[model samples]
Target: MKATTVLAVVCVAACLSIHASALSPFGVGRSQLHKKRWWSSVDVNDLHKYHLDDDPQGYFGYLTQPMDHFDPLINKHFNQRYWVVDKYWKSKSHPVFLYEGEEAELELGEVAYGHHAEMAQAHGALILGLEHRFYGNSTTKEGLLLSELQYLSSQQQLADLAVFRVFAEKKLGMSGTNTWIVIGGSYAGALSAWFRLKYPHLVYGSVASSAPVRAQANFEGYNEVVAASFADPIVFGSEKCVASIRQGFSKIEQMKQAGQLAQIVKDFNTCQDMTDPNDFKTFASDLQGTFMSAAQYNYIEGNSSSIGTLCQQMMVPDPYQALVKMFNPGSTCSDVSFKDFLKLLTDVTFDPGAMSRQWFYQTCTQFGYYQTCDKNTTCMFLPEVDLDYYFAWCKGGYNIPSSDVLEQVNFTNAYYGADNPRGTRVIFVDGTIDPWHALSVLKDLPEGLKSVFMKGTSHCADMAPNDPDAPPALKAGRLEIEKIVSGWLMQAEMEKKHK
Candidate 1:
């Protein structure tokens, strides 16, 4: 079971609708912040506008899934939504590409367009998108109650996929014939690789793009990568850009310590005054997030901002003011209230469409991907936004202790083998500039595994549609993926014939 790893760059061009006074410290709704691609502007009700044709062959549907896949006594079930596109299917014997959904609602646009859809068309395969449990319309009737959310774990989600495979096999008339190739980006990408590792008999291969396979309580490597990206030559980043950012953050910290809160608030256009230490930390987190977002999606097609653009802004005479302007555009008042953020996250009231709370819960219970600044000295963010600052959210939101969060993180890494994942026929793809890549499997393994690391690319850039202006490295990475997938399918066909 040899696998190949690919490091490729991809960009997401989703719009940002951040408010300074939002409940989350990220200065935006947590639901929108965590996804691999942000669909902030795409209304779920009006997704038909993105369809290639009126009533395209791809249709949306739902599957009745158990709320507790491991607990037989629960006997509870929920309808998990999915989208299917069989327009390009050569026959039942052809391959099936399943796009594993992530933290947000599964959009039809995902199944209708993107690299996976293009691959489906090229390979004459069936395409399916399965929304993760507790997201979108895939929720238990009781909603996001703390007790109910206990059922929402990666292990449970993996079981859901296994169950879906069984149902699809019988209903789609492809039992034990068609090969299943799972595909996903970010967290879902981790799932795709884990699925092949856990249930290799079910899925022949997987494409895990920009997947952070490791779970760390304090992800200091994230900011380190961002800082390094600030000096990347491909994006016109220079040492001067990195130095300017560091100096700007140092000035802001000094201002906060010197009791210049009023001046800082006015300069940054914050919605509220920074009276509390928590408030200052929230403000710093917001600034750090702006940089993270830019670096993560730098040069990505359809992106609102890029590293080159950010560097230009940071290199100005007034770096501190330039950083503030980038974060609070149009002189909008940014929210810097940690109390309000805690209140929002602690609210268990379930909105079927909501994502932040659910994602926060997962971070506390399963994967502790807290991008803390205190761990790395080269980090551009203020150290005030440390691990404890994030731990407060988990403790207040779900009463989950920091110790428990660390334990869960350890369990996740141990269970999945972290970056040394034990899987075959899995293509692990990551971009050099993507902070998440630090947690992914970057080195080639001895088990015939391959890793493709694309230089000067953004997060999940290879997952985007084929673009004429895409970097040469990204283009080469995509071709490598296609070739690998083709090889897998061909090998599977040969094995079937021999059997």
Candidate 2:
């Protein structure tokens, strides 16, 4: 991908865990009045609005994650919190559907309203949602201590899922023939697809929605896609809007260089005028994150559209004012400020949910997935997220050798075969606009393994319920996904009958 006339492509043009790309960790502190963490809200109304609570649609339980999955006899295990919601069908032959939870807690959107739900009804299957370890209550503890967090790797959770499958099979009195299909979006999606590869016999098939199977330490293509999307004429975005965004970025860069701290503080409504280069960089990152989050979650449903809304606002005449418009829509004052708009973050306890910190730990130690920008890069909003951040996290957070991160990441890539996932029954689904898609399997694969890349779409659009106003590409993608999954079930059942 090149730096097109509109956007930068690594100068122009990538996550480690298939985790949902994040916003800047610059939100105000947690609400002191509310003990609930961000995303901890369980109300259905709160589900999509940045809420990250335990499964509101299901119940919770515990499963022990092995300290060492390879050594079964070495039983230094910790109980991990697990959640589930089950709806069984009449016939014993009905298949089971499992939604692999991601960095955020589990939600029922996949099961209650999407193609997965429709399939569950069509097959009269059992639907279950499992929260990923360390996200919800599924942890040795809060993971405050480095020792406790060490076991929270993807490999450890994969083993944990295998154990759950057997326990679930017996508990449901499922016959040898009744098969299970793992399903998830984002990190969970990556896990779902990989599970089948790692434990072929355990799951009949998988749907990895927006899964980033490949782990790259530097992923810059993310911003390039955002640039591409902004210039996409079909989505109502215009090159004018793209140019306005570019101008905004350039203006900010100029401001910082000129030591016009007072001007920037006035422009984005910073809490205070920042003179320090590091503080300026932090502010720039937060600004860039606004674009990252908006672009990645550009799915449109009815009047609700994330990227569309932001792009429209970018059309505001002045770049600085345009930024405030796009990033702080809630503000109405003639003299608006960014901090005033996000006053909640002012709370010291402010962690919308602890997932940001948690995911950061995983990335530094195992994934090396930093969404960086550089001379050859394009996410115009962010600076080159220095390798120092990863090094510091590793040394300070885990007391581990910083140099070992690359080696560990290499070993992990080899262990999982991200470029060449060895699997028989998995479908890799991705959105053309999703930055993570660069590291995911976007092309067709082996006989039983395949891929679906949807255009004019954003992250995980297929994972949600089929909105009446959804793009035709997603509806078509879901149809193909359903057909593929149906075939896998038939194959699994046929094998069962022969046995």
**Cα lDDT for residue 417, candidate 1:** 92
User: Which portions of model 2 show Cα errors greater than 4 Å?
Assistant: 1-59, 65-67, 71-76, 107-113, 301-304, 325-353, 382-396, 399-402
TM-score of 2: 0.81
- lDDT for model 1 comes to 0.74
What TM-score, to 2 decimals, does candidate 1 have? 0.90
lDDT of each: 0.74, 0.61
Candidate 2: residue 225 Cα off by (Å): 1.1
Give the worst 10-residue stretch by lDDT in candidate 1: 1-10
Q: Write the per-residue lDDT of candidate 2 for residues 191-213, one digit (tens) a residue.
A: 88889999988888999877777
Q: State every prediction's TM-score relative to the real structure.
A: 0.90, 0.81
Candidate 1: give its CA RMSD in angstroms. Answer: 5.9
